[model samples]
Target: MEKIDNIKNEINYYLNKEENVKEEWIEENHPIDIAEALSELDASEINDFTKLLETEDLADIFEESEKDLQIDILKCKSSEEIIEIFSHMAADDITDILGLLPIQKRKELLRHMKQDDALVVKNLLGYDRESAGGIMTTEYLLLSKNLTTTEALNKIKKIAPDTEIIDTIFVADSNKKLVGSVDLRDILSSDDEKKLEELMDDNIIKVSADVDQEIVAQQVAKYDLTVIPVINKSGILIGIITVDDIIDVIEAENTEDLYKMHGVDEEESSDTTLLQSIKSRMPWMFINLATAFLATFTVAMFEDVIAQVAALAAAMPIVAGMGGNAGTQTLSIVIRGIALGEIDFKDNWTLLFKEAMVGVINGAATGLVTGLILYLMYGNYYLGLIIFLAMILNLLVAGMFGFLIPLFLQSLGIDPALASAIFLTTVTDVFGFFVFLGLARGFIVYLI
Candidate 1:
């Protein structure tokens, strides 16, 4: 953190100096660091800092900035400047920035871009922002399968400056259909007369353009690939998704799932305004309150029993709280497994059984300790027995509901992570209270 602060200070210092020094300093630092520093600056400072760098340098920093900051930085530039910056940016990055802008502004900017570049960006913009096609770049090496090693190498050199990745170059047939891929090393080592088709790996791992980003991420991780090709429905090569973009996709998806699991909107962040935060959070807060009331109603049903056995009130929270904790533990694991594609509907029965057994074992262990503690505290044998049995029952409820709720949500075409914990807590709380209190009601004479 201190190092970033130092870098930010240094950038600010250079921005105020002569243009030559500022250009040199910007060139010396990483684009990510410059972007981080720009984020720390005020509006006027960011405007001034942007003016100091050339379009190419600015484009690098622009590509590294967050979507909001990217828009802010663009707001400081003229139409001509923005177009020039767009020219230097990768197509995928340009599409991302444009996607965040209003439709009119996005169309105007695309109008000014070079006709071919605008067409590419427009095509990219047509896909869902969370799909493989949306995160892929058109700027990748594509050599004809008929090209000899020497010809391919020469072609690569000519286009490498505009390409996003050259480590693996894709091959296409005369009909422009993707056929195979060849490593840069393979091309370098092959005989100059050898054909690309002979040297290329015919077996390829690729995804359709419309495939979800999560599935793309899983495939990339499973195959240990640094880059994956994207294809259209006709099996024609369209774009390539590099590892860097995949990393960002993975992070964004994980953050989204985590936020949804906790009943928070993924769009809300610490930097959001008070009103924005309230808007995002109020609905979830109200939903939780409703669930809380349901638990209260369950307790209200057993009010007479609770009144007679005062010890029930004291021991009630322990049952519900422990059950909630246990449910959350199971929910977290199941959600993670689902996200990673480890759990499918075919395995639901086996998975549920395994989790139920876990609940039983954990319940037994925790119930023994809880029973011993209650027995020591009150010197009532039945109180200990009631709590022990209640713990086991409540935890069993926790495990079963936790495992089933997510799968049920998923089968209904809903995101399993969305409010899953909220549902699990409601189930655990209501069931835990009912079981613990009902047991107390049965043994009230002894407990008293």
Candidate 2:
């Protein structure tokens, strides 16, 4: 609370003209800080404050803001000022914001941009939003293989303004095909006469433009690359995906999986309207209510068993609840392994056996304790034995469904993280209730 108030206070001080928000202030503070402040300001104040900010600074703050907030900030700026800000921003980010606008508005916004800049964004907008071409930037420095070390250094200085990072320079042939790459140190260490072809290293890792963003992130992570070049189907370098873009992709994916795991829409934000949140959540809640009926119907099938021995009613829920928790634990591990690409079909047999043994061993241990407790409380040895068998059966069933559900979902081309939990819960709850109640009904005389 204190930190937030302090930031707000600082921003307000500048807004009221009590203190000047200098370039030094913008440079010292983070862009996210400015965005948060802007998010808190009223429409009039937002328009007033944006006029004082430099185009690049305004662009940086917008880049760090949420999509809705970015649109709001843009509404505060004039068309000319907005185009100036776009000129200072990355094409990928500009296209992302523009893509969210109405088609007519999007076309008008692009029409205002420089012809070359607009063309680059138009080409980029053609790619899928989750593809390598979607996230890459055309702003990269490329060197001709024929240039000498000294000549390449001069070319880099000339083109550095348009480049994002020059630490690793990509070298191309006369046909504009990527041949090799070299570190900036490779140029500085070599003699002035050494050509780029002689200094560049081979065996580069590159992704095609059409490849999925997730696969692009994985390759970057696997190879520990700072920037990966994106090539066309014809093997010509078009754009580059930087480490920052991969980081964003990883964060977005994790957020999506997290939301889907718990039955929330990934696109819903903290500022989502209350009615919108309800609309988004209502369908899933209804689905969950229907699943609850499945458990209730299973219990209904053995109502006679529960009526005869009231003690069975007390113990039945314990059995089902335990199975549900156990299934969740196993599926958590399996789901993570699937997302990280750690699980393989070759090791799947081993994995299934391991989980099954875990179920047996854990079931025996837990069943023994729970059965002993029931026996002590109810003073019925037959009741204890019945529960012990039921528990073991349910737990083994839990492990089987938990292990298989995610794989089945994946095979069907569905996200395991989204649907596996719902299926796993239904399996555990239905089977857990059925096994415990059916066994009690069979040994009703002893249970009495």
Which prediction has the highest lDDT against the true structure? 1
The C-alpha RMSD in Å for every predicted model, in order, reads: 1.5, 2.0
As a TM-score, model 1 comes out at 0.97
The regions of model 2 sitting more than 4 angstroms off are: 1-3, 18-20, 344-347
TM-score (all chains, Cα) for each model: 0.97, 0.94
The segments of candidate 1 whose C-alpha lies over 4 angstroms from its true place after superposition are 15-20
lDDT of each: 0.88, 0.86
Cα deviation of 189, candidate 2, in Å: 2.3
lDDT of 1: 0.88
Which candidate comes out best when scored by TM-score?
A: 1
Taking the tens digit of each residue's C-alpha lDDT, what string does model 1 give over 1-448?
A: 7767887888667666745335666667888877887787888788887777778888888998887778788888888889999888888999999989889989899889989999999999999999999999998999999999999999999999999989999999998999999999999998999999999998999999999999999999999999999999888999999999989988999999999988778998878899998888899999999999999999999999988877778898998999999988889888888888987666778878877888888888898898899899989989889888888888888898888888889888889999789899998889889998888889888977
lDDT per residue as tens, model 2, 1-448: 4655676777777778844468998887788877876788787777777777778888898888877778887777777888988988888888888888888878888899999999999999999999999999999989999999999999999998888898989999999999989999989999999999998987899999999898898899889999999999878889999999999999998898888878889989888899989998888888888898999999999988898999988998878887888888888888878767777445687888788778877888888999999999989998888878877888888887888888888878899888777888888889989988888888988877
Total clashing pairs for each candidate: 0, 0
